[model samples]
Structures are given as structure tokens and as C-alpha cells.
Target: MKLVSYKLKQKPSTLRVGFVMDDKIIDVQEAFLQLPGHSTEMEYMLPSEPNAFYKIGIPAIEKAKKAYTYVMENQVEEISFHRDEVYVATPIPEPSKIICVGKNYAEHAAEMKSEVPDYPVLFAKFANALVGPEDQIVKNSKTNKLDYEVELTVIIGKEASNVTQEDALNYVAGYTIGNDGSARDLQKRTPQWLQGKSLDNSTPVGPWIVTADEVGDPSNLDIHSRVNGELRQSSNTSKLIFDIPYLISFISSLMTLKPGDMILTGTPDGVGFALNPPQFLKGGDKVQLEIEKIGRMENEVIEGEFHY
Candidate 1:
């Protein structure tokens, strides 16, 4: 099942959670209300926010699955919205921690001229950097070397601490696409990459999350990125130096992994910075990313500095 967080055009401020079925988004809360057994308490089970939605744990997934199945089999039309009628937000709009792994792909590590680490290299982005499929990535005047990193993002489903790599996948809610937008100049200027990595509204995170059960064996999917329709990166998750399970186990040993937290599994070779003449994103350039089975997301790059 494809899970989404969206806002209706008529109620722009109100966030709603739903499931995608045949390109139509079925509102989970509304679907619940349509069911005969639904109670006022069911409303609490389905929050408008994705972060809280996951905090409910396995029952959240089960309820969403039931609603999605019911909507499909019963032809429930009133609660479903067409793709263009709603604003799609990031699957986890306010992730507690957006943990990013650097140099996870061997080719990407080579292009950056960095040694392959025996341990995972992790960094972070905050909620401020998160944007949805409908948003624009602002290219500020302060940074001249903007780059894109397309990664297979893992969304944690439940609280996990000191779990084994073998048992790590059990904690995953699903997968989504993440564009790790970076300010190359700012990144290279300091040993710590926080300034370059977490620019506000720079990263575009989701079209929606494809539930883990629906996306089995994520270790070998095709992943690619295009800038202005020109393919810049083409690779596979099979190339990941530190796979999802290991990363979860390694990170969980140090910090608790909670529901709605994200892990960006790093990008492949062919970033703009590695080009002979770097091709940083400019105003109006569209960055398109696709990971097989998870779907695609495109965002426009707007010129000028962001205010506030």
C-alpha cells in the first residue's frame, strides 16, 4: 500500500493522511468514518500528520491496509481524491531525525576522493529542510555550488534500540525517495557538513511512502536521477556499502530509532561536482528522481535567495 500525507485545495491548512489506489488518494480518516464499525476513537487512530500516524505502531498499518482494501473492493468514491486535486506532502513531513549516510556507494566515494569507511558515515537534516513533491527547491545567491544526491530513504516504523542487523528490517515502516540537496562550497569549507547539508527547503523528500510489505528485497532496485531531463546518475541499491539493515542496527546502538525517523542511504556516482565543468542547479532547472517500484518525484529550482 502507498501511504501519503496531503492537503485538499479547499482546506489548505488541514493535513490529511491517505493511501494511493489507482492514482486516486483515498483519505484514511474519511474512509474510517465510512466504515460501519468506526467510532469517534478511530479518529484518534488516524492522525492528519504522518509522524503521529506512525507513532500508533502496527495497528496504524493494519488500519490503513483495511481502509485501502475496503475502498477498493467497495468502490468508495466520496472519500477519494484525484491526483491533481490535492497537495502531496513528504511521507514523513516532520521526521524526528533525518539521518543521512555519506559515501555509501563505492563509486560515489571514489568520485569524492574519500576512503571507504569501515563504519557508516552519518549526518543529519532537520524538518526545516523537508519539502514535498509540490514544492520548489530554492537556490540561494549565497551558495554557488548546489548539487543533488538521489537516495533510497528508509522510514522507521517503531522504536528500536540495539537491534541486530538481521532483525532491523522489522522496524521499517516503508521506503521513499530523498534528494539530498547539498551546497558544495559550504560543505567543502568546513570539516563538519551541517551548513551545506541542511539548507532550508532545499531537499525534496517524497511523492509517498511505499509500505515495506509491498516493497520486498529493497537491496537491488534501480535508482536514477535527471537534471533538466538529462540523466546525471544511474545506479542500483545493490551498490550500497552499508545496507539498510546494518545501518539501522549500527545507528540504533547509539541512538533510539523512532517511528517516522528517516535514513538517507546515500547517492550514487555522477553528482554535478564530479563533472569536468560542474553543473550546479540553477533557477528553473527541474530535478527528477526515480527508484523502481517506489515511483518518481520532480521539483523546480527557483532563483534568488530565500527570505526568512
Candidate 2:
């Protein structure tokens, strides 16, 4: 099953959690209420915020799945919505932690003139950097080099610490698309990538989350990115230097991997900074990223203002 976070045009400030199937969005709360022998107080069983819903662990997923089943069986239309009638937001918009993997792809490592590390090279992005597929990547004038890196991000489903690679997949909620937007000049200006990578509105996280059951194997999936419909980076997740299971195990060893934590598996080669003449993103540029099983993300760049 696919799940999404959306905002109706009328209710722009409130983010609504939804269950998406066949391009339709089902309000998880409303759908749950329609189930036979349902309780009104049980509405609290589901949270409007994606991260909070995830924090409840398996119950959250089961609630949506049950709702989906009821909707399909009863053919309910009142609880359903057309996909385009709302604005999509990042699936886990307020994740507890946003851990990123750098140079997890060998070619991406080569293009950046960096060596593959023995362990996962990790970094962080905050909630403020998060944007949805429909949101614009604000072109901040602080730096001139803007780049895109399409990554298949893992969403944590359970609390895990020091788990073995064999058991790591058990704790994964599912997978989704992520664009690790960066400002190269700022990145190179200092060793800490937070300034370059964590700019506000830079990271476009999702159209929705495809549950692990639906996605099956997280490895060996086809992932690609494009600029204005022209393909820029194309590769399979098989090329990841550190695959999902290993990443989870390794990262968990350091800190507990709780539900709602996002782990970006890193990007492949063909980023703009590694081009022939180095093509950086400018206003009006459209970036698109797609992953097999998971959905696609298409966002445009617009010049943002500074009120200093």
C-alpha cells in the first residue's frame, strides 16, 4: 500500500495523512471510521502527522491497510479523493532524524573526487530543509553552485540497535524518493557539509511512501533523475556501495533506529557539478527523480528573496 501526506488547496496549513491506491487518496481517519465495528475514540489510533503515525509502528500501517481493505470492499466514495485535488507533502515531513549517506555509490564518489570509505559516510539534514514534490527548490543567492542528487531513502519502521544485517530489513517501514539538493561551493568551502546540504527547502522528500511489503526487495531497483525530461542520472540500487541492510545495521549500531527516521542511501553519478562544464541549477530548472516501485518527484527551482 502507498501512503501520502497532503494539503487541500483550502486547508493549506494543515497536513492530512492519506492512504493512496491507484492514484486516489483516502483520508486514513475517515476511512478507518467507515470500518465495521469501528470506534470514534479510536480515531486517536491514527495521527494526522506522518512521523507521529510512523512512531506508532506496525499499528499505524495496519490501520491504513484495514482502511484500504474496507474502502475497496464497500466501494465508499465519500472517504476518497482524487490524487490531483490536493498538494502532496513529504511522507515523513517531521522525521525525528534525517541521516544521510554520502558517496555510497562508487561512481558518485569518483565524480566528487572522493574515495569510497570503509564505513558509511554520514551527514544530517533537518526538518526545515524538507519539501514536497510540488514545492519549489528556492534558489538561495548565498551560493552559485546548486546541484541535485537522487537517492532511494529508507524509512524506519521499528526501534533497532546493534541489529545484524540479516535482521535489518525487518525494521524498515519502506522506501521513497529523495533529492539531496546541495550548494557545491559552500560544501567545498568547509569540511562540514551541513551548511551546503541543509539549506531550507533544498531537500524534496516524497510523493508518498510505498510500504516494504509492496516494494519487496529494496536492492537492485532502477533509479534515475532528469532535468526537464532529459535523463541525467540512471542507475540501479544494486550499485550502492553500502546496501540498505548493511546501512541499517551499521547506522543502528551507533544510535537507535526508531520509526520515522530517514536514511538516505546516497546518489549515483551524473550530478551537475561533475558535468563537462559543470551545469548548476538556475531559476526555472525542473528536476525529476524516479525509483522503481516508489513514486516520482518533480520540482522546479525559483529564485527566493532574502529580507535582510
Candidate 3:
């Protein structure tokens, strides 16, 4: 099942959760109310927040699946909400942690001229960096160089610590696409990339989350990016130096991976910085990141610095 955090266009400022079946978006809350067994307790049980929704685990998935199936088979008219009628938010809008891997792709490692490490290189982005797919990526006036890294993001389904690589897949809630936007100048300024990598509104995640079962093999999928309609990065997850299972095991060993937490598997090569003479983003540049079987996330760069 594909799950999404969204709100109706009429209530763009509010957040709701849903999933897509085609061009239509089935609002989970609304669908649940229409389901046969729904009650006051069931209403209370339904997760309205994206992060809280995943806490219930597979049962929530099962509920959505049953509701969606019922809606399709019996309550077709009730789906008055269309995909165009709602705004999609970052799938895990307030995930407790947004951990990311760097240079996990071999070609990416070679492009950056960095050694392929035996271990996964991890970094983080807080809630400030997270934005919905449709949100504008702000270009700060502090520096000129901005870049995009397309990555396959994993969302943890349960609490885990020191999980074995062989059983790592069991802990995954699902998958989504992530655009690891960076401030190139700030990143190169220091050894620790936090400043450049975690700028406000820098990360664009979603369209929606595709449940792990549907994605099957996360390590082998087509991933690509297009900046302003021009193809920039095109590679497969098969090129990943440290695949999902290993990364999950490694990361969980260091800290507990909680439900709704995210792990960005890392970007493939072809980042703007590695190009001949380099290419950086400017205001109005549109970026599109696509991962096979998941979906495409498109966002545009907006001019000027962000202010509180």
C-alpha cells in the first residue's frame, strides 16, 4: 500500500494522511469512517499525524488496505476527493530522526574522489530541513552554489537496535524518495557537512511512501534526477556500495531506529559539483527525483533568503 501525508487544497495549511490507487487519493480517515467496523474507538485509534500513523504498524496498513478495497468495491461515490484536490506533505513530516548516508553509491564515491569506506558514512537533517514535494526549496543569499542528490529513503516500521542484517528488512515500514539538497559552499567549508547539508527547506521527501512489501528488492531499482527538465543524475540502486539491509544493521547498532525514523540510502553520482566546471542551482530551477516503483518528487528553487 502507498501511504501519503496530505491535506485538502481547501485546507492546505492542515495535514492529513492518505494513499493513492490511481489518480485518486483515498483519505484514510475519511475511508475509515466509511468502513463497516469503524467505531468511536476506531476513530480514536486512527492516526491523523504522519509520524503517529506508523506507530500502529502493519495493522494500520491492513486497515488502509481493507478500507481502500472497500472504497473501490462499494463506496466509489464517497471518494469525492481527487488527487488534485489535496496537497501532499512530506510522508514522515516530523520523523524523530532524519539520518542520511553519504557516498553509498560507488560511482558517487569515485566522482567525489573519496575512498569507498568499509562502513556507511552517516549524517543528519532535522525537522527544519524537511519539506513536502510541492514546497519551494529556498535559496539562501549566503552563497551561490546549491546542488541536488537523489536518494531512496527508508522509513523504519518499528523500534530496533542491533538488528541483524539478515532480519533488517523486517524493520522497514516502507520507502520514499528524498532530494538531499545541499549548499555547496557551506559543505566544502568544513569537514562536517551538517551546515551545508541541512539547510532549512533543503530536503524534499515524498509524493508518498510505498510499503516495503511492494518495493520487493530495494537494492535494485532505477533512480534518477532531472534539473529544470534536463537529465542530470541517472543510476540504479544496484550501484549502492552499502545496500539497505547492511546500512540498517549498521545504523541500528549505533542507535535505536524508531518507527517513523528515516534513513536516506545515499545519492548516486552526477551531482552538480562533480560536473565539468560544475553546475549549481539558482532561483527557479526545478528539480525532479524519481525512483522505480515508488514515485517522482518535483520541487523548484525559490529566490531570496529564508527568514523566521
- Against the true structure, whose lDDT is highest? 1
lDDT score of residue 177 within candidate 2: 92
lDDT of 1 by residue, 1-308 (tens): 89889888865466778899887888887786676667777554567566788776556887788777777889999888998888888777787889999999999999999999999999999988888888899887879998999999998888999999999999998999999999999999989999999888899998998989999989999999999999999999999999999999999999999887899999999999998788899999999999998999999999776633
Structural similarity to truth (TM-score) of each candidate = 0.96, 0.96, 0.95
| TM-score quality measure for candidate 3 | 0.95
- For model 1, name the residue pairs that clash: none
Candidates' RMSD to native: 1.5, 1.8, 1.7
Writing each residue's lDDT as its tens digit, candidate 3 over 133-186 gives 878888878768999999999989888899999999999979999999889899
Error of 1 at 166 (Å): 0.9
Clashes of each: 0, 0, 0
**What lDDT does model 1 reach?**
0.89
Query: Who wins the TM-score comparison?
Result: 1
Q: Is candidate 1 or candidate 3 better by TM-score?
A: 1
Please report how far candidate 1 places residue 131 from its true position, in Å: 0.8
